[model samples]
Target: MHVDLTRDSVAMGDDVDAPHRQSLHLTDDASLGDAVSAVLARPYLAQIGGGKATWLVVVDGTVSAVVAQQWAGPRWLADARVRAPGAIHFRYLAQRDPGEVYVEYSRCQGQP
Candidate 1:
């Protein structure tokens, strides 16, 4: 899995209104793990007090899935789980609002 850091917006707990942007490039298919791992590995994720990041899983020029991660705290705890090839669900923060983000597989679209 090749994970690309498309966008990173981070704001510390004290300043939720202010966020900084970070750009990262990760192109090694061998080192890339699941969506959660990839998101956690972002270089700037650990430095932020709290924020959201979006990743695009690109395979041969097409985006297979979109991953969104939001986290806070010293440990940066988050829950990211994939139920299917194109489906992922995750939750963060004290509210624990689960977010279901996925992309329909191109091959499986318009089929029975």
Candidate 2:
């Protein structure tokens, strides 16, 4: 299943077919943390996208390397908080890498 979270809502899906995917509309009014928790409520496999995230290892990508990297986690979310009314994007990685995950949030440009 795929899970997504925004500043105000959470969505989930179980398949590649967009029309047949599933989601849980948690709320329209929420904090970033709340949205994340709501997303965690669902079940999934892994991640691919990292927004100011840290990973010990990455594979199959062009930049496949064993390296340690970290970013301003809270500050990025803080930026998102300031840019409210944003959208959450969630997707599944390849079936071979079910242990991967991808989660991201971004406010529409010029929407202050």
Candidate 3:
């Protein structure tokens, strides 16, 4: 995914105020909810791709999910975002027949 470091944020702990929180733009199909659980468990991404950056999935101005995915290899440089590895969860939010995926990340960890 084309990560916009200028538009990303991060909250270390369970503090009401996030230590670092900024608006990020992710072009990949991954969402935010996909990364929440993984991030909570481990701050860093194991592989790469979607999990590389912590994201918030927003659809129509509402938080639909959290996403995190593994990173891709160098061969995937052509379109890194499309090959991200991670999980997407929108259980709390209502599912749309055909919804959009928005991933907001702190940084863009390019493919190896």
Candidate 1 residue pairs in backbone clash: none
Candidate 2 lDDT by residue in tens digits, 60-97:
12111111113222223132232112334332222322
Runs of candidate 2 with Cα error greater than 4 angstroms are 1-20, 44-76, 79-86, 91-112
The number of residue pairs in model 1 that clash at the backbone is: 0
Off by over 4 Å in 3: 1-51, 70-112
Q: Write the per-residue lDDT of candidate 1 for residues 1-112, one digit (tens) a residue.
A: 3333333233345244223333334443333234435455655333323445444344334444444445331121122232212222222222222132232323342121
Task: Rank the candidate models, highest TM-score first.
Answer: 2, 1, 3
How do all models score by TM-score?
0.29, 0.30, 0.20
Candidate that beats the other on lDDT, 2 or 3, i.e. the better one: 3
lDDT of 2 at 16: 35
What number of clashing residue pairs does each candidate have, in the order they appear? 0, 8, 28
Encode model 3's per-residue lDDT on 1-112: one tens digit a residue: 4321111323323234322332333446653332233233443322323334433343323343344332121111122233323332121112212112231222232211
